[model samples]
Target: MKTKKHTILKKSVLIIVTFLILLSLLGQTDLGNFSSQDNSEFNYVTIQKNTIRYLQKGQGKDILLIHGSPGSIEDWNKIIDSLSVDYRVTAFDRLGHGYSSDYEYSHHIEDNAILTNQIIKQFNLKSPLIVGHSYGGSTAAFMAVNDNNSDQKYIILDSPLYEIKMQPIYMTTTLPVLGKGFSLLFSYTISDMFIENGLNDILVSIDTNQRNTIIKQRQHIWSQPKVIFNKSMETKNYNSDLKQISNRYPNLKSHFTIVTTKDTLKTFRKDCEKFHKEIPNSSLIYLENTGHYIQIERPWAVLNIIRQKMEGQPSSYKKQ
Candidate 1:
């Protein structure tokens, strides 16, 4: 009886492994050409052995825009044009996102900060105001805290500063042997549906053109198995990374302009409040009814806040 049970367990394990292998193979078929955006319009430069793509326009004060996880430089599409008119706006695709080249090893928020600082140095940007959203916000904060330069200014938008509870998909994709297969399979099946739902959930309104552009940008996230896999690793590591960086927050020299939506998740709102209190010279602004993607929902308000910050005036706005 014991021998029979052992044989059955072995067969079940083999069957599962075989299924996973097959699933991975099937999922690989869909890995066709994927471009997050029209790379032709952007400028490319090599930094730290990685080819980075960035967009720079307007000519005044320097402003660096950092996007969130699974996002690209296109995340700033609505606000970049307006911002570039007044400031030299620079936006880029972080490693493994959009058209940026991916590396074999996992890159964290610290790496992002390092890469962005290099961009500032390489481009000769002097004392640029860094604006970051979500994960990008964390990256911006990381850059600000570690830098000795007191001139660096940062605006953090609804970013997670504490540990995050991993989502089911994230958990599945981080698993050992089967993770790659599962993520690949997920990409081929329900990935786009999830992306669409998430976009709808975040944005107040989405026209045909806006929807199409966003969908294309998001598609790059799941277009390759490794990309999705790296994303999952990022989600898994984010909380621990944030914890490590928390001690340095109090030492940050830059004034943080934290903008959060009233309708954002309770956890994120709480974090934003806590972060504002913890940091020395920080101001918190609450926008009503706007979802997580506040810039897209209310770009004008963001612009007003930037202007106010630059002019050293208090920016208070009524919810629209």
Candidate 2:
């Protein structure tokens, strides 16, 4: 009787495992049609081996937008229309994200900065104002410090500028074969759900329409295994990159306008404050009742800040 009971228990466990495997496979099937067919309106440029996808509109001083981890050019959709009205707005899918060609995750911030510079040179953008969000902020800072172009100014939107505690989940993706397998499984099985939940948490003040568009764009990119791996590498290596930036912080020449939110994560806000203190010339602005997705929540406010900066206004913000 005991043997029979053990056999039954084993069978029950096998059945449960089989059911879960089937569920994961079914989820992949449901999301298999991941394509950027909706973004055909954008143009592409081949920078080296990577085919960088971008959208350019209006005509004025170049306003380059760089998105964060697991993001694409579409992240600027909410504010692009408004900003394009006054400036020549350009946004691109960073290599290994969106429709761009896949590349190995080098975990060095300078790699992205170099690619950004290449894009600027290829398009012959004359001292464009680069606006970088989240991880893109690091890229912008690198560009300012290294490119040494006197005309370049920057707006960092809710970026992680100081040291950060790496999450174990992110570290897992930096492993060898295990990382590739795990990234593939996550991307195929639950990337959309992860993207949706993350967006909901970060974009607390966004409207339904804007939220939906952001989610769609992020989901399309997050579903790709290469993009997922790249994000993992970025998170895992962020602390090292921050250390390098800290060493070169004083050398940053481009003027900066840093934007943050009242509702930002405690650690992230602390980093922002540290960044502000280190860079005395940089201006820091706080938006009340906002989260990490400040660009989407308060596009008009961002536009005003940009306009003020362009008009040569003095830097002002309450010191924390």
Candidate 3:
């Protein structure tokens, strides 16, 4: 009876493993043909063997906008028009996000930062003010630390500056071969539904119509299996990158304007405060009632801050 039970257990395990391998194989079949209908005017530039989609408008001192994870250049649509009116505003689809070409390397924040610097150089942007939101904030921070231009100004919006614990899904996708398999599986199975549900929470200040539009756009890029794996890698590398930045915070030379909403995660708010206190030339702003997507919810606030930075306004803490 014992031998029979052992044989049955071995068969069960083999069947389960076979089923998972088959599911992962199904997940590997690329189903995403992601497209952005609003990108008719967008242009592409190849760097490091990866093609990046970008948009530039208006003319003045340059302003580079770095968007969040699982986001595209369209994430800045609400403020792009206003900012582009006076400033040479530039935004792009980061590698593995939006329509940009995917790479097998880990999408670390530092890599994005290096890419951002390359964009600055490639586009001939002259000491432009950098505005980064969410994951983009980390990229901006890394750029500011590495670049020698002390006069460069940065506006960070609701970014994770400290080493906060990642979600279980993000953790699960960091495994070796299992990570890729899990990312593929998740992308094929529930990534769209997850993104749809998540939009409601992040885009709280937007109306139903606007929120629906964003949800559709996000669903397009995030449904790609490569994009899913890219995000997982970024999240996995976030903590180590921040740890490196933390050591160099005191020596940071660029002026920083950190903005956060009243309804931000407690961990984010705490980190924001800690980041503000540590950096010598950093200023913090708090906006009431706005959720995570402050740029979408309060474009004017971001615009006003950009204008202030352009005008050489002194950094000071304020509430909006």
How many backbone clashes does every candidate have? Answer: 0, 0, 0
lDDT computed for candidate 2: 0.75
Give the per-residue lDDT digits (tens) of candidate 2, residues 123-187. 88877888998889978877776765555678898888877677677766677545655567688
Residues 248-318, candidate 1: write the lDDT tens digits. 88777678899998775532677788889888888999987677887877788888888777666886664
Q: Can you rank all candidates by TM-score, best first?
A: 3, 1, 2
Which candidate, 1 or 2, has the higher TM-score? 1
lDDT values, one for every candidate? 0.78, 0.75, 0.81
- Candidates 1 and 3 compared: the better one by TM-score is 3
Query: Which ten contiguous residues of candidate 1 have the minimum total lDDT?
Result: 27-36
Top TM-score model:
3
Please identify which of the two predictions, 1 or 2, would achieve the higher lDDT against the true structure: 1
* Candidate 2 regions with alpha-carbon error over 4 angstroms: 1-38, 148-151, 208-213, 315-320
lDDT of 1: 0.78
- Number of the top-ranking candidate, with lDDT as the measure: 3
Q: Give the CA lDDT, 0 to 100, for residue 258 in model 1.
A: 94
1 against 3, candidate with superior lDDT = 3
